[model samples]
Target chain A: EADIYQTPRYLVIGTGKKITLECSQTMGHDKMYWYQQDPGMELHLIHYSYGVNSTEKGDLSSESTVSRIRTEHFPLTLESARPSHTSQYLCASSGYRNEKLFFGSGTQLSVL
Target chain B: AQTVTQSQPEMSVQEAETVTLSCTYDTSESDYYLFWYKQPPSRQMILVIRQEAYKQQNATENRFSVNFQKAAKSFSLKISDSQLGDAAMYFCAYRSAIRNSNYQLIWGAGTKLIIKP
Candidate 1:
């Protein structure tokens, strides 16, 4: 089983509030990714990390920022949340040299 | 940049029957991987099946199988003896073999699979 985990399964907050979504994996994978998805829509890659201390922006533009201080942890933070940011965020981890992504349970965020 | 396409937005299958979902991609790299993932109401994306471009033999897992045509850039999933538990949003994804851009997954707008019991 995939050991990737995402916290705050669901969140609802007012706009301008700061929020952080936590993601961690116990699988000792080298690569991790953050994706934003709307209900029934395609997934948009927001941020990704190849290893510890390596974080890069994905194809989609996102105001949120991510930090990879540890290999097992990659958390995303939105300094000022907006209603437009309301969506499901998925965390995934892959092996050293492959693209077979193992996904998390996902966190659904709603900014009011 | 590689792109994955799932033209069918929604599909329905009767319990105990079979169904197939279409997926296609565009890529310049010859060695790549194609994946099918299922997302239930719980919102966990589960890997259904996988196919390697260089492998001529198709990939299968239990009742799920993939028809991967490298030349056609087509990868479709066929579920046999469908069950209500199989109902979910199925996403088709692609990744390159090249070292520089292998980390990214090119995703298709998923197809929602509804099972009629």
Candidate 2:
């Protein structure tokens, strides 16, 4: 069973549209991360949060923004989506005791 | 900067046979953790096995085992008695054992395992 969950497994939107990807973890993990992946490619870290009110940009640059107001809830928002934003967004969470991450079903976004 | 590489983009194996998937990483840090994750057609990323760099002993779980060569910077997953369910995209990952709660994971391009009957 997956402790982490992501909403809207698949999405298609026009350019200039705004969208938010929701991620929630039931495990109450303090560490949450967002990774962008291309088909058959390596995963690129885009955003991460240590806990509530803590968020940081990852190694990879992204136009999207993320907020961690609640311990279990972390959402990524793209104010103005573009074709370059079209990719799979994966949400994951991990506890401090062990660094093993629990990943959620990724959200595939397509911008036309 | 750390980088993990999986040379084989794809590998084929017959059912009930053994196969090894190669993984090598480049890092200056001495202490870290290595992992192998499997992503099947279901698209769910699952943890297959893990190895700690500090340990000299290898890690194994049932049909899955890892030949971790810390000095050589190599971590390979060997599957014994391959099953159809084992056919999936296998990824190698690296993580620092640091105390930072916001630790990040470094991943490879992944190798697709094909099981033939």
TM-scores, all candidates, are 0.97, 0.96
Error of 2 at B105 (Å): 1.3
lDDT of 2 at A3: 88
Question: lDDT at A90 for candidate 1?
Answer: 97
Best by TM-score: 1
User: Candidate 1: where is the Cα deviation over 4 Å?
Assistant: none
Candidate 2 achieves a global lDDT of 0.92
Model 2: CAPRI class = medium
lDDT of 2 at B105: 82
Error of 1 at A92 (Å): 0.9
Candidate 1 lDDT for residue B97: 74
Candidate 1's TM-score: 0.97
